[model samples]
Target: MDYVFGFIGAGNMATAIIKGLVGNSVVEPDKICVCDVDMDKAQHLSTEIGIEVVSEAEKLAEMCHIIVLAVKPQNYAEVLEQIKGTMTEEKVIVSIAAGISINYVREQLGMKCPVVRVMPNTPLLLGKGATAICPSENVSTRDFGIVKSMFSLNGTAEVVEEKHMNSIISVNGSSPAYIYMFAKAVVEYAKSQGIDENTALKLFCATLEGSAAMLMESGDDPDTLIGKVCSKGGTTIEAVNKLNENNFCETIKEAMDACTKRAEELGK
Candidate 1:
């Protein structure tokens, strides 16, 4: 708890991270501080989560040893500019902003402080997230380990290359939405077929969980697994055929491409 943690945004992601840090006993409530443009939000986190609320971003930057830039990508420049004077090489800057690079953050702050770029998904709120972490060359091994350990409280956190950070967004950062959309479509079709909505949803979710486990545990690749379930001309193969006919894989590749493109644009 000696390392004071300050968050610049009180949004859901920030709240989730703060909750993980405090709830898991990684940091005491008193060691954490937060400030948001919306006073109500800052107050809510302070009142409900038992953390201190600062009046300005600059003040938070000045107070904490580990500063997390939890604001949006577009807001990064402004926040960095405001806290530039407070930032020192000793302080660690952790950015969860998508599409924002460690170099961009260092340049914006006009300092060569340790910068850790993280791509985290909404599942962090449920303590079942996947996060990709990359750090600048100046980041110490100790600081990087702290960040990786903290993220492990939520879910799996992996170290990736900075060159792959943008591509990583499509894989984990925005994939939850794609899964939800796919689930929604399936649920809608079940309802249209007069099946109970809740039952279909429950079964589908369980199937998703089992499928994920199989993908991880089974030695076979996706195509091999598909062949296993898809007994020649069976119902599973029929559905698979239809999806293939409709360019399902191609469509997904295109979607991922679009996501990467947007991330690149945001970084620029």
Candidate 2:
């Protein structure tokens, strides 16, 4: 819990995590280090978040006991290669890259390093993240506890089997984009019907938050909740019937299937 943390990519997701850690006092700014391909990005994070900035991934890895691989999936190989030698058995590599498996990272690092795979949604910026942590066998109980606590600074975190890690990519990691798309469409439709854009935005967003809160607190399943809202011949049922006619549920399933398949491919 007192260990230094380093982020390899000082981008948006990395920034979110940094802010969560520092904002929640999970770790001190000085104890957190960041490095990026761009020195400007690293320096910006250093200035904005008060974290230390290193010029190289290897340097960051050496200085910090916990390393966050926040880089893109395409760049994982290069970054891992650079820091492989510094990945001591005690160090924990928490990778945020979707579809990057723990076994794949260990092979890339050429050691049975302690690697934790996490799929966190962007809402982590608001400290309301839904993060799933999948740890390799090399990771100890303390490692799991530390990672979970650190992630909890931003939001809820759950541990799942590595076999379900890729599926989690679609569940919460990529689900934000799907929700955004639906929100955008609904807001635009409301605008087309003469509702003010700002009002529509606020209304829909709050509805989203409230709906999720109800789902979490109500102790009832989604179908039961939906039934409560849908009267025999009500407007809700009309819309639901339309959605069914258009195969909305089937479409969502198809999308998730594609997402999981692509995730499997990426792991390969």
Candidate 3:
């Protein structure tokens, strides 16, 4: 496709998307452009990715068919103001800022341009992230499909109601930290039992990977799978009892609810 893709920031998320687009041949490097306040960072990324780098956001917006707003949430309004007049109806604007609403972007831009809000976590760097995409009313099916396909090149993408974006952030975006914490705790517990760190890490990671695969391939409910693993009066049952006694599931629910509340607060 003869399309131009532009990014307003050269941070890690922007870099990851650029890498995916270029590396996967989804868009040609020459057709991509980036702008950042940090000229050095923009220049470095442009050099590494073989894309055009402009020092100004307006210039990038004027040139690109798709403009990705990859700046932090706090800077989104000013960035939108700067690029407002440069965007045309034909341009599709995608925002990766956490807690930024589609209406907020639309109001800031003062036009009915196609706007897509996406919640993608840092794991996108590994091409295994899960992203939730929400498109505004101005976006056509073709435009939404194109944006979703671009993200699917790097990781899984799902379209959902804008109201559910905060829940998706809690479940998929911020949940990675919870998984990492659990892995760390598992490793530390193993170390306390005289196991080496490397060994513990390998075992823990393998278990996690295998369990995830089982969930996907087996098509069985999580409770059913857990029941299968925990036999009556078995070691697994003992562990399950301990976890239940500690209200592990309740704690996880509470934590996720807190994450959703925080996301809502930030968005507001």
Candidate 4:
């Protein structure tokens, strides 16, 4: 609660998290510091968000108690190497780099400093993100809770074992793209059927929002919900039958499998 948060990257995810913390009044804007190779990007956040901008990653690491490694996976080595010397067991490392595991952070740092690995989706930019928090053994319970609460303030945050982090990529991290692709197809189909493009997009997007709410609030299983939409011999059932005939479910499963596989590969 009374910690200086430092972000090692000024990218979108970092900006989103930083904004969430400051916007929600969870952390004071002045208590946050950010460093990025691109000073323009870091200055943008500082100028707009009223956070401090550090010239170097190590300076941010030295200044903040909770340091977020929001850099890209490929840049993790350089950033970690740059800041690892400044890191101590008292300081917490929160990593948002996809496919980078907790052990990887520890190994790269060559220390037993507390590490929390988080997988957060882009929806966090809109404060509707899904995040999975996985802390290393060295992380204290209190520190883990702080990390979890910080993410929860931004969106839905759940604790998950390290082993499941990669698999979670398919569930929440990469799911937005899947939903968008499905929406695109539906909107395109509607447009081809003489519906206005913007109207079709708006209606389909609203349908998606409403359907998600129904799944969460209606307390009905997906199959039951499908049944609700599909009457005994109705047009909805015809469409459902067509989807089933075309192995829609199987295709989704395969896509998820591919996503999980790539996540695993990236981790390695």
Error of 4 at 191 (Å): 1.0
TM-score of 1: 0.98
Provide TM-scores for the models: 0.98, 0.95, 0.95, 0.95
Error of 1 at 150 (Å): 2.2
Clash count, one per candidate: 0, 0, 0, 0
- Candidate 3, run of 10 with poorest lDDT: 1-10
| Top candidate by TM-score | 1
lDDT of 1 by residue, 1-268 (tens): 2438999999999998989998889879989999999989999999998999999988888889889998999998899999998788999999998889888988988878998999999999999999999988988888787777678899889999999999999999999989999999999999999999999999999999999989999988999988889898589989999999999999998999999999999999
Q: Model 4, residue 164: what's the lDDT? A: 90
lDDT for 252 in candidate 2 is 91
Across 108-134, the per-residue lDDT of candidate 3 in tens digits comes to 888878899999888899888788999
lDDT of 2 at 170: 87
lDDT of 4 at 243: 94
Best by lDDT: 1
lDDT tens string, model 2, 85-184?
7778788999898889988888998888889999998989888899998888878898678778777888999988888988888899999999999999
Model 3 global lDDT (CA atoms, 0 to 1): 0.88
Off by over 4 Å in 1: 1-3
* Candidate 1, position 137, lDDT: 91
